[model samples]
Target: MTGDHEPLPPGGRELPALDGGLPLIGHGIPFFRDPVGFLARVHSSRGEAVAFSLPGRRMASFCGPQANALILGLQDDTEVDRHLFYDPLLAPLLGPGVGLTAPSELMKWQHSLLLPLLRRDALTRHIPVMFDEVERYVAPWDGHGTFDLLAVMRDLSARIAACCLIGPRFGRTMGPALPRLLGRLEAALFAFAVIGPRGPLPHGLADRARETLVHAIKEIAPRDCPEGSERSHFEELMRATGPGGSSLDEDTAAALMVNWLFAAVPTTALAAWTGVLVLQHPQWLPVLRAEQEAAFADYPPTTLSALHKLERLSHCLLEAERLHPPIVVLPRPAARDLNIHGYRVPRGYVVCASPGLSHRLTSVFRRPEAFDPDRYLPDRAEHRTTPQALIGFGGGRHPCLGATLAQQTIKVIWSALLRAFDFELADPEVREARTTVMRLPRRPCTVRYRRRKR
Candidate 1:
């Protein structure tokens, strides 16, 4: 067999390509309508590496774990380009300090400062903040009523981002308006994901929201701070400096913090999916509650010790993430004619890998469609022993940085909710809404809840 680097050896068949019937939106409609289903069908029929003539550019989806390791594992932009993949959508909201939109070297340097904030030690402090934010956000919920699960989860996530990510000072400054403005930012992201980025986006709305964020953050954020113990992520960002102690300006500082939210906050998707899945599989309800009872014994589940004891709950959440991944596909533009997964991908083709598809492959998971949390148990770790078997969090070299934070946040949220009240889905048949950014439960995913006697 010819190598990916070698030219289509003489009579070697060209990489299989598919073109949709539409003009401007070739295959995008199907992709947006049912991303996982369509992508899986394509990979099942065609070869692992297949190309689609998308609206503006061509895209090559490298399916399965091997493709994930090959495509997502690309460290630098030498072969594949991440800087351009989400630039148009993320540039406005995330600004440009330590992200795909910034210069590679500058991004690398800035990442050094930003990443520590998401580490175990740094995140330990945020645990209490997440619990506090969830409590305050859910305080308004009545003793018994029907509510939109997705909306509640989204609001809670925004609240946590304001206090934990932007700092409590920023949260207090914005007060009631914190989530409103932050919602505007998330809404823009939702629009981009629901409709494929190849389609039109609400750039104007995102730009206005970002300007507001930059202004608000610049007003309260310090230009620089003496290196020392920090209270929140923003404080650490204020202390970060470039070569020769080049201090961060107010605007850049604000934008960098916002960018961190994009990287650090896992949005409402994980928690929301966990909720829907838990409700769908009522069999696990008592299991999770029993685990929580023990985990929260004597100490709040926010503590590391308590959190570790909630192993079964964590396994159930892992099952949810595997079933309903937030983003259907992770795409990076190929820098040049590169050999990817033994396929000749030409320059500028958007190289793609779908965790949404890989997670459900029967080859990777036994009875891939079944909602069995036991699969995550140590003895039956089906996702183990493979490089990228579980790509739900975009595993491999470029895994999701916010994955740990997201899992912790969800566990905390569940501990609080499942302890305080008993909830049942008003519509038990809740399925994932078709959005690439957040796999929210479809509309009318209402839940009935009542305060429980502790």
Candidate 2:
């Protein structure tokens, strides 16, 4: 019951500790294999705050509402420099100028510059492009052959990231190569995280991919940008200045693009999971369709006003994220000593919160393991009681800036897809995979799509 500054009472339990890690690798294997289960087990057996080791460093897993709020809602004592955790994985690709690694003032400036793109007016303007991208990507699905649903969604997302965020010309110019390049970049980043730059093949591929991205950015430099209505993020980057009034250089521009892609690609990947979960819960299909029908009775739900009416779709997505968040762990480096639920956490310690574990806690959620959008209903509002219960997009000082766009993009794409076709999972028992970072749905998760007979 004591505040963060208050000292622990005499003999009060210290942060519950859990350790059985391998000699050198520490808990890497177990932590990666079943991160959700591992954290949950530790929290249940140990306590709200459980300390564990991972490879080279000791870490603490903050669980339940009290610990989760403490970790996520940390103020004045902790900060999210991507270097804290993402450095080993993405720093090579994203560089240091992005919001991920930049200082507070720099990050604030970056966020302010990027805010206009994600605003309601901008998203509304960008809807046609999003719809076009989604429709064009799905046009070939004919409801005939089974396709990897996640793969399709990922590719589509990459294209949308290019088309809407960068420019349609860039998207089309890159064509299929953009996603392939992105795939290679992501794989290489993951590999680097696992083994360092050991293998020649992956390292070479990553190098080449980075070179290609840099070249692409230089090729499309603002001077080369076509006049008229080609909305390009590259141009935006060129025009934007830091807090010190310096325009983005090639490295910073390219890094910002990569960072933006990192934010976008994963959320869009989760769109596929949303589809899979909804297909598994067939009962919701009719409900979603009905809601869409009512919401867009007068016109298609592509506009900002129209998109707002699709309440049920939003609920379903919220529930899906609660059950299977893409970014499971939110890591922050303590900038100063801190007290969390009375546990003394020192500066430089990697304090973490897990949406993957917290979302499934029986204490906060009624039936944590179940898929129930009703938990967010007006009457229920389960997340209202907790400070940071639903952190699929993170929280605290620096939440995901693109979160609103991510949800809208997913909703728009799925709305169009569901209206156009009926989806049947090739394997109902398919599960989500943990690929070192995101909680992705299984590869080769196929689905049969049949065009809606209107």
Candidate 3:
């Protein structure tokens, strides 16, 4: 906790902070071992805003609704940079231009072009594609058998996201190569702590993956005038910006796609599996099933528009996000010196905001730990107390661009599954995957599926 002392801001709060353990490691052990429990304990004892030292770096964690808002609001500040954490893992996959590392101007431009595709009109256009993909993915499930839902979700989402990002043909053409690319990328990320820029093992795998990714990118790259272009977002982005109306080069595009995979794949899988896990709860299943039945009765069961009407299902997903946020801790580096609750945060220090901890504050959510979807209903609107309190998709200028897409995809898959089969968890005590930063399921979440009685 060694740093230059400065006077606290007037009328600001000063609080106790954690001095992390050991040299080099800092609080990495406790953080990775039991992140949720560790954070919860810290908040209980230290209050909402606390500071900690990790490997000579000082960090302040904001755990309440107020802190969440402040951190997210800072996203648009030229001083606040997201690249510190995002660049290392995403650069090789999504290219430098697509992820946080891309120049801020390019990121803004890309966002503008891509926003329409995710808007209501574009979402409407894509619904049929989503439903068709969902039906295809679930077609193989037997009514009386058990299967791993996690694997099912990963494959399904990768394919669906591929369809949305590139096009149906590109998704199909690249199918055989997708898994290997994903595996290599995942391994590289896991090995990142040990792998230096010149490290033999990490560099070797990254190089190979980059080659495959580049080839795939070229295959999907735009050739003709970008009308009804599935890859138009990328082409239009290039054509409308920078030198020759283009900015991100091939490698950057590849890296950005890789970053997109990291962003979209695991989170989508976890959200889908979490929905399934929630459905397995005997009490909630009946209510959810009833909602599904009613939503389907009024409109065709297979369309996206119909699924949008399933407000109860949306609430269930929201509740799941609240209870088990896929990324429990959102880490951002300070772009400039700033004061949070009177505590001085110097530039380069990493600041953390934990949704897993903040979402449980009873101050904002009644029975915060309970899985009560009704709490999110418009009338209750408990989360409206603070914008930061309900940031499942994050907040501010850098908030997840794919949030709507992720939500829509999850709802579509769940709706299809519930309509087709009755399911339950194969194991009662199956735990979620908890790494230092990301939280997901450990393996294929097995569930027994039986035909629903019509």
Candidate 4:
């Protein structure tokens, strides 16, 4: 009955404790092997919030909707402790300023500059450019009967984000080199498992990738500033935070650019691929297509507003996000002592609110296992009851700043594809790729597309 701040019980089950999993490895193995199943077992047995450990760390898992609300609300107090995972993994490739590690004030300034560029007006100006790029990329598909949509979507999202982040000319010029840079960075991140006490091997490949990105960024630096118009967000960040101002320096900028890829590319690609796979379910496609057609009836058909009008399409995406979130577990280390649901959590303990498990709870979502978009429709309005439960974009102050822009980009791409082609899953056994970090569709996920008949 007490709020999250209420004092914990003296010595009962309410005391700071660890539950589930083995002694040292803790729950790391099973939790990664089958996250949903593991969390279900823990929640059913231990009640809403249960304590568990991972390797050298002690953490608590929160299962209920209330727990999600409580955790997300603390975003301001809890700066993202990137060191535990992101820092160690990504530091080799992306120096530092890319994500949560950037000095707080610099991040805020950069975000403010970036937000306006992703606003409705800016999106309107950029759709034609985005659509043009998509068309060029997909143009070769005519002769290719079957191709992995996963790779194609990844390439598409990365290129589009690059264009939006820099400018059309710069994005196009660097487009060919991007996939290589991304591959190198990904390899470095994957190499973390083997990065022993000797420390990560020189990582020459990752270093070269960073160099390539810096050269590309410098090549595209504004030749002559347009009258009255300021520099691009990336340029602004470099100038303000560069050697002179906050002076982030070239290596830092390269790292920040790599971080930009990490922040936007894979996650957006995953959402796009998942949206496609979800649409493959025979029952859902027709409804989604109809909704798309109706929404575009009077509008320019490619505008941001037109894409937003596809209520069912957006709902279907929300459902897909609920079912297969790109980032599953959000970990936070307590800065000070805290009490939650009668349990005391001491300082430095990690606590996680998993969208992967929480979104599947029937208490928060009706028929939580099924792909039912109507559950989020205005009439049902299930997500409204507990918005934090839908934490696909995280929550509170640190909520994914790129969320709206990501959604708008996804919707536009989906709209263009659906309008031009009829697509169905080419492989019978398509499955989602699972990693401790990001979720994506497994490779060789081919989609058969044909020109839609009028």
- lDDT scores of the candidates, listed in order: 0.72, 0.74, 0.67, 0.66
Candidate 4 local distance difference test against the native: 0.66
Question: How good is model 1 by TM-score?
Answer: 0.90
Q: Which one is best on lDDT?
A: 2
Candidate 4 stretches greater than 4 Å from native = 1-24, 75-86, 183-208, 221-233, 239-247, 297-302
Give the poorly placed runs of model 1, Cα more than 4 Å off: 1-13, 96-98, 172-176, 190-201, 221-235, 243-245, 263-265
* lDDT ranking, best first: 2, 1, 3, 4
How many residue pairs clash in model 2? 1
| Span of 10 residues, lowest total lDDT, candidate 2 | 1-10
Clash number for candidate 4? 6
Model 2 residue pairs with clashes: 143-449
Q: What residue pairs are clashing in model 1?
A: none
Of candidates 4 and 1, the better by TM-score: 1
Per-residue lDDT of model 1, residues 294-338, tens digit only: 767664544677787888888888888888877777887877776
Any runs in candidate 2 off by more than 4 Å, and if so which? 1-13, 76-82, 196-205, 221-231
Give the C-alpha miss distance for residue 119 in model 1, angstroms: 2.3
Ranking by TM-score: 2, 1, 3, 4
Q: Give the local distance difference test score of model 1.
A: 0.72
Q: Residue by residue across 121-163, what tens digits does model 4's lDDT show?
A: 7777667767777777877667336656766666777777777
Residue 100, model 3: Cα distance from true site in angstroms: 0.4
Could you give candidate 2's per-residue lDDT for residues 1-454 as a string of tens digits?
A: 2444332333444666677777766777878788898887777798778777775566767777677666665553233234656555565655655765676677678778778778787788777778888888777765456778877777777777776666677777787788788877777766665555455766787778877877786676444342255545677777777776767787777767766666666775578778888999999999988888888855344578778888888988898788888776888766555566667665566788998888887778998888888888889999877888888888866588888888888888788888888889988987767663576787878888888985
Models, CA RMSD each: 3.4, 2.9, 4.3, 3.8
